[model samples]
Target: MNIPEYLTSGILESYVLGAVSDEERREVECLSSIYPEIRQELDRLSAALEDYALSYSALPPIGLKEQIMAKLDFGTEAPPVETETPVVALPADSGPTYKITWIAAASLGLLVLIFSFFLLSQLRQAQRISATLRDSNETLQTEIQRQRDIRQRSEDLLAMLRQPEVRIIRLKGNDKAPTGEMMVYWHPHSRQVMVEIMNMPPLPANQQYQLWSLVNGQPVDAGVFDVTDAPQKMGRVIAQADAFAVTIEKRGGSPAPTLSSLVMMTPVTS
Candidate 1:
């Protein structure tokens, strides 16, 4: 808007030399379109610089000029390009605009290439991680199946120990109970034992069910169990048991079954 300050800013020099950047050139173009004074100053400065360049131009050697003029006159075809910048044909040099556009386009293309490469690499990595997780899930499933098979076999062996072919002994609850009863599972082939108690009263905290094997009419301690609604069987039970009896003994059972405290008596069928 101010002619003096705009002229003093050296933009006129840059425009005349075609050295202005694209952004600067666009700004100058807008100012020239809107303000007549800025355009007047640019034209005046450009003419002065053009005249100074022409002032340094010297005449060609005498006959060389005549020979060039004679050839120009004789040729009827198009004239050849004589200079890099043709002052009469162009108002401002357009070469730099093409160069800047090419640079910007190449920069955009390189950025797109890099972004596509990065996205593709991430996709491949994600696929690999998913595959690894899938393999881990498969391994866990296989291990679970194996553990289930082992547990099923153990349950089958326990069921066989309670089979009817194995001997059984029924014991009726005595003074401690009026109508309660208990049963023992005995296998002569394996010499393993399990016991089940039904309708028995709860034992005192420090007391438990003690099973005794009667050998030669003397009580040999089989082991101890805790009977509630369900049966509680001792582990690795039979040594050499003939008949079985029950008593209320202290926890962990006495070394021998207490005679006076006997509850039920039942002989082994085998």
Candidate 2:
């Protein structure tokens, strides 16, 4: 149990104000008896509230007794009217008791009002905590799902690479980019193609890298890709190609390749 957290949780204030449910009341009582610090704090709060109530005690108005007596008929001969109910007379010494009862009732009412405000504050705090926890749980779930997808993609890529029919092509830098390099995986039977960036220079925001398959001296648009370390799947190579090349293009690939922007190229081998 985190003692400091429990101490600041507002349960003690609720317990002292007599606003806690029976189960919570019992928990407070049990914990207070077991912990000296809790007991001391509970006693201090009780004393403080008692002092506060006494400070706000209502006092009787001045000359109240005299005013009441002045309004009564003290003359010996007084007319009496017949009534269905009999009038009950109070004992002469009931003044002090009545005064004490009235003060006690007023103090109880003030305590009740204070307790209501404290409980409301506690409820608002609890609602905020609940909302924060709900958001955190949703974020955690999204991250977990993202990781699962990444793992599944990695496993699939490994399986594809192990196939006997797949061919590996290493494209080296051309005159346009002396240090750029890339790898291409091609499955002739399935016509599937995947590209991996080994090394590449960064491009401008408005430009991306495009893959081209040269067939009968004509460049075919394979796909466009971003510069990332992960292996990316591209358009299938339906016909056998003589070579593969990469070029810088607009955000999306164009119908024809820009020969001047060629960065890497590799000729196919039998």
Candidate 3:
């Protein structure tokens, strides 16, 4: 409504007497904020009521002011100091700008450091595990290589033994070596008979044991051999006959075995 119409509605009289309803108070407060004239009128109305009230109380008994002041002071020598200072305490976990930012940054940094330490520790542990696994793999590879070598040797021996024409000969201890024993294998097709000597100590570096194949009544040099065959494969080949022998011959072997070194001999089966 227009200002004149609002004034004519008798609402200004109610406002002047503090009788404004709650709804009317809100409307008047909004209008007063928007309109300078309305605000001025409200201010003037408040002054008028104040002045009217003062005029109405003018006949009050004198000495009322003195009575009010005397009761408050009790006639003390020093006036009391104002003990009530208004303190605006901020809420917890919230406050000034510098403090809030500092707290937030410090909290984030601590969390990052903790996580980084944890990640580093895990990485170190994983490296240790990888090293252990590498060592284990190397060990397994070494064992596999050794097994392969042994299996190959065994397979070679088995293939040789399967030949039907392979000869087997036994050599008894010689007269000087009463209890010494030996054997010979003569595979005619392969022409590779082996000699096995028992308790024949390791040969000197430049010396070796010799084998002899007796043909007719004469001793013929079969070949020289070493420790690899001394225990399981031994002996000689006789083109014409039936006997084999072993002796501590020289390194290159003797066309004829030294009689004193004669260690063992065997006769072939017909």
Candidate 4:
């Protein structure tokens, strides 16, 4: 239920005035226990009533006790009454004490309300920042994985080239491009070959570089690949070749190397 609204309604005032029905008094009592604000309001009303009572509090008029005693004559010769010490009752608490207590409680409630709102705002902002950081962390993890794969491939290629059985073949450019150069790492025993574009000229958009292995004087298509900062492992050469060459052909590469587009070639040494 909307406790604040119910507290603000006239029910509390009626409860304070002792004018509410029994059902309403029970409801108020129940709510007061359930809601601190309701309880605080109830205390405030009680404090106000105490203050009102204190405002009109005074000593009884002088000699009024004698008038009450004279009215009750002791049958014109009743036995003499025994005298005893009269005791006066004092209130356990003063009006101002209740007032101070209520004021302190109300102030505390206000402070609690303000602090709660500030804390809630901070929590929401923290959640937003956390979400953003989580997304960034995921993106960074993906990029790190991609780099790791690249590094692993580079390592594998280096390990292959370092094998004692592998032969390094340098292919020099022909008259079409004198400065273009490339290298091939070939393991004759395993027929494994890795291609590295050292200083090859950039090809047109619709063309790509293709490797060819010459076996028995016939050109065999090795594979087609792009030039990157790292060496690329091409398809394994199925047969021992006497020479290897590079040519620029259509993007997907031709089934046969175009002799006219040949850029560089190197004959196997051993």
Candidate 5:
């Protein structure tokens, strides 16, 4: 297993923050048990988060206990009973009972208040961790999709090259770009055309490379394309071409080839 890659994947952080799904949580537990490095990192992240939460904790104001107790309305003592006989005096210890009860009530309220503060701090920390995990997941997904696209393009090019009916045409450089080179894959029966860029100079803004197919000495538009490493499908060749050419044109291309901007061309071989 690639231990370093796994460590930097952000899963460990999510697990430590209690934000992972059940399956992921189990995976982390299983890995941590087997790998000491994972276990150590997990411990470190957990301790760091705890310390962060504590750093933001706010202490209650002084005399808060006394203030809460003062606001509590302990019910008034009962009035002395009206009796025909002599009334007995109450015990001294019994006089302190109400005071003890009020003190207990105040302590319980203070405990609840402190617990609420701790819970709020924990919730905020979880939110920040969740945002970080979300961004990491998005970036990972984009990279994965990009790799898939490149693989698919390569497979397609290989399949096209293997077709018996497909003809390979190499267009070499002209005076405008002596080092420019590109390839065209043309299927006569299907009239499909694909271009692969080998080497070309960068174009200015609002300009693109346009392919032209010469049929009976007349220029026919094959399509506009950008210079890229991957083979790109272009407009179909409607008829058999005597030659293939490339020229610089406006971004969307023009109806007719720009003769002065012609950069590459090659005659078709039987």
Candidate 6:
């Protein structure tokens, strides 16, 4: 059940004040044994009531005390004495009783103070836990959104590859690297281009693979790319090209292709 809501519904206060029905009283008793928060609240409420009662404690009136003493003197079962008897009663000292009463009151006040401090500490600890849970929940939501975005991108790429009109160009290895092979998916209708690295030798840290579009018998820089199993988008195909080629270049690529570094090229068809 919603324990916090139940506790804040003011039913516990009625239960503490002894105003609840028998059923409710039993329910509270049963839950107190099962839930620590409920039990702690019950204790705090009871302690508060006891402290209130002690705060207003008062002695009996003087007239009421006299009547009580007179009744006690006459109601005794001792028989009346015929001879005169001397009444030698010494006055009683109530110093110890008064001191003990104050001591008990002081101890009760101390206990109430300690209970208040404990309740405050628990409240602070609960707030800290709530804040931590809130932060963790936010982080989890962000990660979930990120994964969903990645999944959508993968689906889009797969859809592009399934298009029958998309041109699949197989670029073969050249003298620079005999075993290098790569595939380029050029979707002219959608103006999208992607590259799949099948087998390409790894390059040094300061070098990377770059793609070039052979347009009008001239090499136009498509973009610099990396060799990964997953398909990587090389931006849109802006120029009409007869064939595509791959070359190793400086890390950030160059304005024009480096012919000596050409590692692969699309087959020349006549």
Q: lDDT score of model 4?
A: 0.76
Residue-wise lDDT of candidate 1 within 22-78, one digit each (tens)? 999998889888888888978886776555445444434456544544544533444
- C-alpha local distance difference test of each model: 0.69, 0.79, 0.66, 0.76, 0.79, 0.75
TM-score of each: 0.40, 0.53, 0.40, 0.47, 0.53, 0.46
Estimate, for each residue in 125-221, the C-alpha lDDT of model 5 and write its tens digit. Answer: 6876898899999999998987887677778778878888788999888888988998898988778788888899989879999999898899989
Q: Put down candidate 6 lDDT per residue, 1-270, tens digits, no spaces.
A: 889866765666667766689999999999989999999998998888677667745454446544544544533344556775645553332233334455666666656655554565567668768988999999999989877765765677798889877778899898789998888877777768877778989888899999988877898787888765566788546345688988899998998888898888783342
Show the colliding residue pairs in model 5: none
lDDT per residue for candidate 4 within 1-270, as digits (tens), equals 987557545677667767689999999999899889999989997786566555444444566455554554443433444674454444333233234444555555545544544565466668768888999999999989878867876897788877778888999999998998888888877778887778877877899999998988899888887876668788646457899988889998899888899988889987
Clashing pairs in model 3?
A: 194-234, 194-235, 195-233, 195-234, 195-235, 196-234
Native-structure RMSD, model 3: 36.6
Give the per-residue lDDT digits (tens) of candidate 2, residues 62-112. 775655555553444334548745555544333443375457767786767
TM-score-better candidate, 5 vs 6: 5
Candidate 4 TM-score versus the reference: 0.47
Instruction: Give the winner by lDDT: 3 or 5.
Output: 5
Better of 2 and 6 by lDDT: 2
CA displacement after TM-score superposition, residue 59 of candidate 6 (Å): 16
Per-candidate total of colliding backbone pairs: 0, 0, 6, 0, 0, 0
Ranking by TM-score: 2, 5, 4, 6, 3, 1
Better of 4 and 6 by lDDT: 4
| lDDT score at residue 81, model 5, on the 0-100 scale | 65
